[model samples]
Target: MEIDDLTPAETRVWRAFATGTPVDFRATDDEDPSDGGAWGAERTVRAHVLRALLLDGPRAEGEVPALNLAGVRVTGVLELQYATVDHPLRLRHCHFEDVPRLYGARLREVNLSESVLPGLISHAVRVEGVLRLTRARFAGMVRLGGAEVTGSLYLESTRIQAPDTEGPVLQLNQAVLGADLWAPGLVARGEVRLDGARVAGTVNLTDAVLDRPGGTALKAETLAAESDVLLRDAEVLGRLELRGARIPGRLDLSHARLANPGGTALRASSCVIGELWLRQGPMVEGVLNLRRTQVDVLFLEPEVVPAWVQLNDLTYTSLIPHEPAERRLPMLEKGDSYLPFVYEQLTASYRRIGDDDAARSVQLAKQRRYRRTLPWYGRLWGHLQDVTVGYGFRPLRAGGWLLSLLAVGSAAYGLHHPPPLKPAESPDFNPVFYTLDLLLPVISFGQENAFAPEGGYQTLAYVLIITGWILATTVIAGLTRTVSRQ
Candidate 1:
C-alpha cells in the first residue's frame, strides 16, 4: 500500500507523518471550534488511512517521527508482520479496532501504553528496547511466543481478558528477556505462561490478579531467572506451577492468596532456589505441593499456614519459621497421620541442620499423630507404653523405671532378709547381688536360686522378677525403634 491509496484525512496524516511530524485528532474540552473549543493544529485521520501511511513508511531504518499515533483511534489491524524496522513506535492512548500483528518482526522499541486493543500477536518478534504495555487493555490473548526482548516487558496495570478459562491470556514461552517482567497490577483473566523463558532479571508480579479455577494461572515451568520471582500481594484463583524452575535468588510469595480447592495451588516440584518465603498474609486454600524442591532457606509465617500442604521429599537447608510457627504438617485432606513420611521429611530436615533434639521432637510428634489412628486396643497398649517408656523412643524413661525397680527390690529384700533356697557354702543376704541375679536374663550370680525366700518374701521375689522382665522388654523395644529409624 502507498500513501496515494489513503483517504483525504489519511492524506493529511501522510503529509505530516512522511515529513516526520506528529498528527493529533483529539477534541477540546468544549464542543468544537464553533463553540470556542480548542484543539491541536495537527491533521486528523481514520485508522485505515494511518494504516496505509504506516505500511508505506519511511522505506528504511530511522524512519519518520516514531510512528507517534497517540490518542488516535485505529479502525483496522496494525499488521507489521515479518518487517524489520529500527524506528520507535508509540501508540499511547490509542484504541485499536483489532489486534496488532507483529509476527516475526524486529523493532528497536515499541510502546502501546494506555491503549485498548483486542490483543497483540508478536510471535518470533524481537525488540531491542522495552515494549511498554503499561495500563493497556487486551480484550483477547496476547501472544509473544518465541519473542526476544533485550529490555524489560512492562505490563503494569494492564488488564488482559481470556474468557476461555483454560486458555492463556499471555504467552511468553521460550522468550528470552534481558530485563525484568515488570507486571504489577496486572489483571489476567486466564493463565500467564512463562514456560522455558529465560529472564535475566526479576519477575515482579506484585499485586497481579490471575483467575482460572481448576487450572494453572501461572505456568512457569523450567523458567530460569537471574534474580528473584516475586508474587507479593497477588491473588491467584488457580495453580501457580513452577516445576523444574531455577531461581538463583529468592522466590517470594509474601501476602499472596492462592485457591484451587481439591487441587494443587502451588506445584514447584524439582525447583531450585536460594530461598522461598511464603510468609506474611498469604492464603492457600488448596495443596501447597513442593515435592523434591530444593532451597537454601525457607521462611513461613503461621498466619499463612494452609490446612493442606504437600511437602513430600522437599529439601531445604535452613528454616526460618515466624514466631510460634511450625512447618504446617503436610496438612493433607485426611490429615498427615497416615503419612509418616511427611513427618520424616521434617525430621530429616532438622537432622540436616545438626539439630538432633528437634529431629527427635518431630519423631515424637509423628508417633503421637499415628497413635491416634490406631484401634482402641492398640491405642491402649500404645498409651500404656508411651506414658512409662515413650513406646520405645524414650530410653531414658526406661532407664529411670529400671532404676526404680532395682532400688525398691534392694530395699525390700534387705528388710525381709530371706533364707537360702538351695544348698550353698556361704548363704549371705547381699541385697545388691540378689537383685542383679534376679533382674539379669540367663545370668547366675548365685544369689537368686541359692537363696530361699520365706512365705511373704517369696511374693516380693516374684514381684522383682516381673519388674525385671518389664524393664528388659522396654529397653529392647526402645533400642529396636531407634535402630529401625536409622
Candidate 2:
C-alpha cells in the first residue's frame, strides 16, 4: 500500500515496524483502556494491515522488522495460519475483536502480555522464542495443542474464563516444550489439559486457581516432565488427574486445595515420580488415589492425610518425616478395599528405615485387616492367633501365653490328683509332671498314659489337651509366616 493510502495510526505503526520501535497508544503504562470511552481511529489497527506489514515490510539497512504495538485495539481476526513470519511480534496490552488464528504458523518471539482477547488458537505452531501471555485475560478457550516452544511459555497471572464452554479452557495437550511451562497465578474457569505433554524443564503452576467443579480441573495424564511439576498452593475445585505421568523430578502439590466431594480429588495412579510431596496440610475433600503409583521419596505429612484414599499397589521407597508407624498406619486404613500389598509395602518401608518395631506394628495391623475379610470360623482362629501371639509380630506374647496356661493347669491339678491306672507302673503322682504331660502335645512325661482322671477332673484334663494342641498349632503357623517374611 502507498503511504497516502495508510491512515495516520497505520502510517505510524508501519514506520515504527521498520526500526523495531514500540508504539504505545495509552497515555501511561498503567492507563486503563476500559476506563476510556472508546478507542478512536488513531488507536485502531486492522489485523490484515498488521499481517501485511509482518509478512512483507520494508526494513532499515541494519534493522530487523518487528510489529510492537501497545494498547492498540486490533480489529478483525488476525489470521496467519500456515504462514511463516520471522519477525518478533509484541502486542502488549492490546484489545482484540476476535481470536487470533496462528494455526501451523512459525514465528519468532511473540509476546501478547496484558492483552484482552476472546481466545487464541496456535495449534501446531512453532515458536522459536518465548510466548508470553502474562496477565492476559481470555474470555474463551486458548488452544495450543501440538505446539512447540523453544523458550518457556509464560502465563503468569493469566485469567481464562469460558463458563459456557464444556471443553478445556486452556488446552496444551501433547505439546512439546523445550523449556519450562511457567503458569504461576493462572485462573481457569474450565479444564486445563496438558495430557501427553513433554516438558524439558519444570512445569510450574504455582498459586493457580482451576475451578471446574464435578469435572477435571487439570488433566495431565501420560505427561513426561524432565524437571519438577510444581502445583504448590494451587486451588483446584475439581479432579486433578495425573495418571500415568512420569516425572524425573518432584511433583509437589504441597499446600494445594483439591475439592471434588465424593469423587476423585487427585488421581496419580500408575505414575513414576522421583519425589511426590503432598505435605504441608493440603486439604483434599475427595478420594486421593495413589494406586500403582511408584515414587522414590514420598513426603506425606500427617496433616495432609485424606479420609478416603486408594493406595492399592502404591509403592514408595522412602517416606518423609520418618514418623512412627502409629502415625502412618491410619493412612493405610483409609482405603475401603482391602489391599494386602499396601500393608506389605508400608511394612517394608518401615523396615527399610530400621524401624523394626514399627514394621512389626504394620504387620500386626495387616493381620487385623485381613481378619475382617474371613468367615466366622476363620475369624475365630485369627483372634486366637492374634491374642496369643499378636500374629507372630510380638513373639513375647507367645511366651506369656505359654506361662499363663502352665500356671492355670498346674494349679487346677494340684488341688486334686487323678487315681493312677497302673499304680506300680507309674512314678509318683506329681501334679506338675501331670500338667506338663497333658499340655505338651508332642512331649510325653509318662504321667498322662499312667494316670486316669475321672468326673470333673477328667473333663478339665480334656480341655487342657485340646487347648495345648491349638496353642502349639497357632504358634508354629505364626512363626513360620514371620520367618518367611524376614
Looking at candidate 2, the ten consecutive residues that score lowest on lDDT are 31-40
Report how far residue 337 has shifted in candidate 1, in Å.
8.5
Give the candidate number with the greatest TM-score: 2
Error of 1 at 434 (Å): 3.9
Model 2, position 355, has a per-residue lDDT of: 91
**Which number leads on lDDT?**
2
Pairs that collide in candidate 1 are 420-452, 421-451, 421-452
Residue-wise C-alpha lDDT for candidate 1, range 1-486, written one tens digit per residue: 565666665665566665556655545322221211122223334555544555555543464455666565566567789877666777776667677889999887889887778889999899989989998888889999899999999999999996753568899999999999999999998989999999999999999998888889899999999999999899989999999999999899888898888888988899999999987775678877787888888886655657766666777777776221134433422344366776776676677767776677677667777888999997876776676678666768877876777787789888877776654565766987898777776676778877877787788778778777776776677678888998
Q: Ten residues in a row with the worst lDDT in model 1?
A: 30-39
TM-score of each: 0.82, 0.94
